[model samples]
Target: MKTDLYLDMDHLLLLLLLSSGLQAEGSLNQTDFVRLVDGNSLCSGRLEVKSDQSNQSWSSVCEDDFDQQDAEVVCRELGCGAPSVLQGALYGEGEAPMWTKEFQCGGNESALLDCRSSGSDRNTCSPGRAVGLTCSEPVRLVGGDSRCAGTLELKHEGEWRPVGESVDEWTLEEADFACRELDCGSAVSVRRQESSDRSVWSISYDCVQSGSLRECAASDNSSHWLNLTCSDFVRLVDGNSLCSGRLEVKSDQSNQRWSSVCEDDFDQQDAEVVCRELGCGAPSVLQGALYGEGEAPMWTKEFQCGGDESALLDCRSSGSDRNTCSPGRAVGLTCSEPESFRLMGGDSRCAGTLELKHEGEWRPVFDDYPFWILEEADIACRELYCGSAVSMRREESSHRSVWSISYDCVQYGSLRGCAASSYSSTILLSIICSGLLLQPKISASSSMDGVSEAKQQGLLVFRGSDFTVSCSIQPQYPGGSFELRFTSSTSAHTYTQPAVNHSAHFLFPAAEPAHQGSYSCVYHVHVFSHDFSSESRQLSLIVVDPRSDQIINNPSKIIITVVVLILLVSTASYFYFKQKDVTVPPTVGSVDLQHVQSW
Candidate 1:
């Protein structure tokens, strides 16, 4: 019987492996393709390769043969900046089909295929020899609320170093070059660093307006750091309209400095402020660094807005904490106008698949785009004046006409500002919205009887006990249904039931650790063929282990009761003795009755 059980388990494991459909050894299909896997960013990952007729598969490369030049080629080919770290198997080991070929790159090759390679078979390489890399961004801004304005850091020798302090007088010409190098509009102001921080002044550079910073002469003198501020300018990039596109800002007018705002610090209120600042109406949609990643300098400051602020700078900011902005979190915005996008074919006007109107034709948005997130859903719901997004789903496109454009919304803003491009896909997104008026109230009880005891008992249950959670709608609407949802830190479970007289109950037969979580219910009803939903207040349930209850309630309760009785008796004895000692000192009128009783 033991042998049979082992064989059954082996069979199940084999079935799982087969069902996964992982490629076989050396079965890659792309002949001239390269990609990174299992790493956090585009620059860092385990390297993989493929040739024509073979699918892209994990392959091994010798660490000795892989150099910084070869890694730079790979980074450039992948549209990344430069190589930071190149190590074999640093990301993880690869499978079969090791590329034992000897590669030689000159560090300037546009594609990895352009580099010279000595053909060799996979047999020469050993296991765990796959190459991994970390790439450095070409440019970045530091220490500012806007991306276009900040202390500039440039990548040199695979390390990020601040530009050298000016030996000659620092001029606006050099500052203009730096701003132009970052693709920002133009230079606004140039200022010298007041403090002599040697760490930041490791290298000093003398630059001219026509040449790149790399061509500038370097010195070892540790003096002041050069800080450049670009002009106070704002523009929308990568969109068709002047009011829409990726949002870029320049904070300082004296030192014209600009930087991309991070999505982490942006929201709908911020979008509204940006629109008003740009002389536009309210924003229709807002997205986070979806159009494209900005250079290193990001606006790390957090903005606090009430959605009525006229300017972004007028809102409160998190001062001096610029580290909150991370790479690839730039903000995007799309302002409300006559020619924007809308939702169609949902349970209500507020809920449905996204559609953009262009050239007098409505086009469907493809759901397969990777950038769709909760922030995008929130922006969409808000655009429709809906309360909030309850759920987002992908479904097959009902119509044959697909929108030629794709959007990326990382955080809040107008959807029009999201980077748009031509794309094709068969699936489309469907969004569901819940208005504010439909919020439901949920209660947990020990039993389903009309008189629930759990409410008085704080909704606490012992392990192995049974409990019930009920949701009721006040001034209940007819033809509504209830959907119960349970959510814990790690997992979520959902159940649905038809509402009986405006109430629905969920039962848990045996409470356990898995059942300990906050539960909520939604009351969904169809009115005028539109779906309306109300969510209940969250009900938290706590389940105590039986052993813990025993330890806390049994011997501990007995000890407490015994101690209380002893204290009571001692107090009574003390009072009696005190009365006995005061016999002769009583007042004459008051003591006569006591003396007659004694006689």
Candidate 2:
């Protein structure tokens, strides 16, 4: 019977392969039985077993049976490099029908099913108990200050080590291919260097000018390591200067295309990182698709930076699956050099007494200077990238006979363009300017709109629940108006409020399917007849349906639930019948032989 079952299983597996268009030409490989799920790349995601019963069905593989040897076969069969890391349920849980068989791979098996197995079958498995893996990239850079410039490392036998003999033989074209593979621009410098203290691997490469480094001819040899430096890949386009324009990042894939970044997701912190990476000063202004809209394939990840990261890729960002941004929202940035003049003796850079620079000497202006006006102060603040002038005042104290220079800026040009006053004074001038440092906070509630007593909190809501979104601005200005906008996958809606209130509210009668998405607010005010707007960070609202107890309606769940119930009933029936035949017979004295026989 066991021999017959084995033959039946092999026949079934062959039929599955033929029906799925997979040729049954040779021994079964790992790709024929193993697959990845829920990841952006083939090298990532939860591991699952392709059921021999059908191509459409799969069972989650257990991490308990996973090891480096198993991962090696999986990666090799998938046409990827060796496995860099293996994780247990790190990518998230899988649906039922987990594979319970334990594999004992010898690290040389071509297929997972060909390896020795314990043949254990389990009725149930713990949730989130699946295997995950991150395969090593074929080419990488190492031992450098930045990811772009580093010692070239190649993957051999699931490990990344410095190239050995091929170091002297490597050409500029080969180095360029390596740099492009890592998406770090073209190779600027390639030189032979002494190997590090770490172990070195013997590898030879015959790379061509075209194609990726992975496509190069490779062999084993022993020699020195190669160090390389790649030029900065990021660039600004369609602006007056290189440091001011639309932001586009080069793709690390084989196509080597460039993609624009979405301004709606790019924030000031992200802008700072980009400027610093490009050798530019801090960002003066970040515009949203200002130059012009881009084409398709815009980056949608929201970059989160701590204002100190060396590379934009080093900062934490949203997952690549979030492709919510369109070409119309491409990001633009204007970076500026640090200001020559600075404020002193005040709480902050924007609200301090003013100082001037002249002839390489620091001096102060007259407090009672006749030409002092808001326009001049505005230019000074603009030079510092501190928004506009909020207030200007005189700081009175005992006289210090330092040199003073006055400027008359009549609502035009930079502070340096203003003409200096002929006279000098000992008194100092003090001014306070509105800074771009403030960011508004957004909150949501289930209560009625415009209710001051209700506290704003988390955004979790049920379907058909009435909700209100409010945005509160700091350092309120009388002429500033608030605009609230809501965006979903298909459409967007906006609401506006006049300048009378510092806080704005948008009331929804009930949470509809269309109303679920991201929301943000902007504060705009007219300064010198020109409008300036400050935008807030985006907030996401998730609406759950109480009737279904799910965030959204999924049609597949119904079928899965029915299938699970049927399997449970079949297993229970089989166990019950098997136990009935093995039950002990009742004693003759009990006088229940007829009843026992009937049961």
Candidate 3:
């Protein structure tokens, strides 16, 4: 009986292996039914689906019947990533027969043939309406925060391996192709990474020509790997401008999906990462459903990020998955667009010649009018996070290309939002902000005591000593005034002096109790036809009395005298009780005995 059981078990195992082999073969054969033809790569072209009837025939899918759901299944069946771009006649007009019935794919099917079909037949396909699809290549950047940056890896031979090549073989062109294939904008930089003994797939120049990294020849002898950083991975959509819109993040190396982040799962830190990833300035506003909830799926994970993370995915996430969100729960963010306009060649960020960065090149700005006014400069200052504008000047330099800003458009929105064009001008617009003034410095010196540098702590001075408080500032502007402000529990006082060489002195002939208070220096400057001011940190002053110190220092003598008094009192009380006990007892007893006998 045992021998029979062993033989039966061996037979069952062989049957199971054969079944698995047949299933694998069937899957492979199904891929042959669909092909992307006459395109740059196998993953992108005019999509053609073959029928499974007795007489098999290939036909192009109608654009009307093919939706994103159907495209998802087709791309998956072709062993490619998700669909990236869908258009009509993207490759070329298909020459094959048009498909009749429409495909109703549920988006999770293993193959296009497995999906349901419409009952009715729509036979005609219009010109320039043939469905053309471009699926994302099976390429990714891993071990980084966003999809645009990290170690470059490709799906080759049914496995993912880092791309390895010699240092001199790789260039920006190859990196640009990879970035574009991944839909990561453009290539910013590329670096070679050395690794320990491991497996890698190296490519040659054929990768750019063929538009497919998988089809390129590979080398296993390379020890250097490719690391890339793309320009962007996250974007804001459906808003007024590029800096304000609904937040979408593309993540995960296996299936790249740009999903909207829920407002509940995102915070200021996450917004910061998104803004930085898009090359924008700090986040200005974060609201729910401000830009309208998009059709993308809600993010399944909650990002727990420190504010300083380079990428949103680099931050840690909560263990629990969050797949559901209430209506209007999608996050909408607004970031300041600082990449376009900047101040240069000035002492501070708020004061300089206004320049605009376009196409990665900085050019000086020229107003639509011949001169810039205070109102336009005020708007520019506010955009730069500088205070209100103080003054505007036009300096004539060598003539060059400049970005002309429409004065009317900038009055309403950012300079970047305004329509700009290249213009030749010799004048450069420069402006100073009210926030450009430097903080003043405060110091104290006394005739009786030595000089003390400016400090936040209290300053000590003896009574009847002469002291001076000096206020100074860095020489940036020509002239300014210093106001020495003093505040005490009972009263307050203000002293003003014209700044001489950016310094002012206030003398106190006698150190009084009223002088002990918080003192500060406010520097006031008038330039560019506007008044600007900056106040220094508070300097606390403390007054002391010499007699009081002497009294407190002699406390030990007072304590010893009190101790002697206490001892004398206790000794006297003890002796008086002892003397009374001997004499009063005898006198009282003699008188009491006589009186008791008489009673």
Q: Compare the candidates by TM-score and give the number of the best one.
A: 3
**lDDT per residue (tens digit) for residues 279-348 in model 1:** 4567877877656765535655677888887667678877766666655668878876444577787545
After superposition, candidate 2 runs with Cα above 4 Å error: 1-8, 11-74, 82-136, 142-150, 156-161, 164-191, 196-209, 220-224, 228-260, 264-272, 275-309, 312-326, 332-599
Better TM-score candidate (1, 2): 2
Q: What's model 2's TM-score?
A: 0.29
Q: What stretches of model 1 exceed 4 Å from their correct place?
A: 1-232, 235-275, 278-350, 353-414, 418-441, 445-457, 460-468, 473-497, 506-599
- Please list all clashing residue pairs in model 2, or write none if there are none: 164-223, 165-223
Candidate 1 RMSD to the real structure: 24.9
lDDT of 3 by residue, 1-599 (tens): 00111222322343465567755232335566688888778789998876433346778888888888889999888878779878889888867888776777789998876666765667688998888999988889997777788999888767888988732245444675687678885455566677775778877743554558777737576666788877565667676554678988775534455778899999999899877765577999999999999888888889998989887767898989986899998999998876678888886788989998754568998887635689999989987879888788888978589877766556645676452445788888898877787788888766653545565344656667888889999988877899999998788999999999999999999988778788999999876567788998888766655544421122243443444455456556656767777443332222221111111
How high is the lDDT of residue 163 in model 2? 60
Best-to-worst order by lDDT is 3, 2, 1
Candidate 2 vs 3: which has more TM-score: 3
Q: Report model 3's TM-score to 2 decimal places.
A: 0.50
| Winner by lDDT | 3
In model 3, where do residues sit more than 4 Å from their true spots? 1-233, 238-241, 250-258, 263-273, 282-296, 302-321, 325-336, 344-349, 369-373, 393-396, 411-413, 416-419, 548-599
